[model samples]
Target: MHKRVHYAFTVKRNQKNLHHQLATLPRAKASVKFSDRTDTHGRLETRVVQAPAVSDLGVDFPHATQVAKIIRHRTQRKNGKRSRETVYAITDLTSRQASPEHIAKIARSQWTIQNRLHFVRPTAFAEDASKVRTGHGPDNMAALRSFAVNQLRATGRTNIAAGLRAMSYEPFRRPLDLLCLT
Candidate 1:
């Protein structure tokens, strides 16, 4: 017997979409529940997740075993701006295999990694605005940026922008020290 594959996807907000239908389901029908709130990066965020068995909707999503709805509320400390968003998702894992809490954790972890690496690379390194599209220029630049990020992280510099600034004045010294080179 082959083990079935599992998948998770957000449902779009459309009148005829499955996500809309599932989102309208009663809260009492949810099989799993998870909620968390945290203050980080000058912002406070609250997340609530509900997962329900998708056996009844199996015909619509053959391999889906659970559907999840996540509501996020965020407030910026600096500006006091607040925003709320809702997301719907389907996963192939059953409620027994993956609880709402586990799924929420996974989602948050993925976002953290993405924000750390991908978001940083683009914003801090100005990668998206780079005109280095010829030959290996882009790849080489990416590698160099990755190396810089790793070096900064290894040297106990949590803020890449500040690390880059510090290294800019003494590029040779910092890289040499980071590489253990005299």
Candidate 2:
């Protein structure tokens, strides 16, 4: 089984304040401990009266004290029961001032098959109804399907399962040709 870690954080103006909050919070409490405890508590006291807001990328976060809530939820099964919990927190920090391009890449990378790809694979290719759960058979077949789907997409096939069908049923239109087979 694979581990699904859910990370939720916010962007804000006060970095030190955010760090302190992370230290005091539950899940992140142990993960992040302030090296300089003295300064962590006094961040609000030392703040400039009229500090300007921090703006990065296309968003402008206000200058006032902000609480960034970060929750990292890890789910696991124990004693034949699924256990779930969330850590609530407040902070004013962002891990990175991500570039617009970087944010887009992150968003794209978070895509899950259940939300987009899996249904198409099951509905279009009958992958779900597959009863082949033998040694290496299921794994190999899945790998081939994944490869075929990726190839089809790379070669401009709009629908994934259709590409699988074409690759599986048609010898002349095999992906190996587009795969650079001489």
Candidate 3:
């Protein structure tokens, strides 16, 4: 059942790889193209997307219908630093099921998950810096951190850092009260 589900995945850039070949193709050869620019989180970013038909590539990706390339140019507002990145992806959806604009939206929306969940787990909860390497210790710690984050979000605490600080005063007692666990 999982194999039949439609999905998209980013392709790695490797020499002689199908994804790399697609990425190197000229923009004029693309079947669909889209570009946009935005200022997000104090950084200016321009994303140019190119999508080509999967059938033309002679590659065998199960249920694959389209290949896409995203070129991103980013500039930091404070440090004046600049960077460029090109990403490639393949999706099971055909051109009809997923248009270039729609695919771009899907690709860009992935960052929201990264920012809200992945980033907060590491930075706000200090999960990455933790040295709990014993059997089940890391997993248990991660679960506890996730529970805390969920509790904070559930209680309408928008600022996780502040919520953590507030809970740390009484440690065990405070969290139990916050969650009504007592």
TM-score for each of the candidates: 0.61, 0.39, 0.74
Task: Give the per-residue lDDT digits (tens) of candidate 2, residues 24-72.
Answer: 4333322222111112222311110111112222122233222223222
lDDT of each: 0.81, 0.42, 0.81
* Candidate 3, 1-182: lDDT as tens digits: 36657787767565447665666555565767889999989999998888877776665667777888888899999999999988877798888888777778888878877776668889897887899999999989888887888899899998889999999999979988998989
Residue 58 local lDDT, model 1: 46
Report, for all candidates in order, the number of backbone clashes. 0, 2, 0
Q: Best by TM-score, which number?
A: 3
Error of 2 at 171 (Å): 2.8
Model 1, span 28-120: residue lDDT tens:
778568999999999999999998887875437668778788999999999999999887777788898889988887677767667777778
The superposed Cα distance between candidate 2 and the true structure at residue 40, in angstroms, equals 40
Q: Candidate 3, overall lDDT?
A: 0.81
What is the model-wide C-alpha lDDT for candidate 2?
A: 0.42
Query: Which stretches in model 2 have alpha-carbon errors above 4 Å?
Result: 1-108, 112-116, 165-169
Please state every model's RMSD to the true fold in angstroms.
Answer: 5.4, 16.7, 3.8
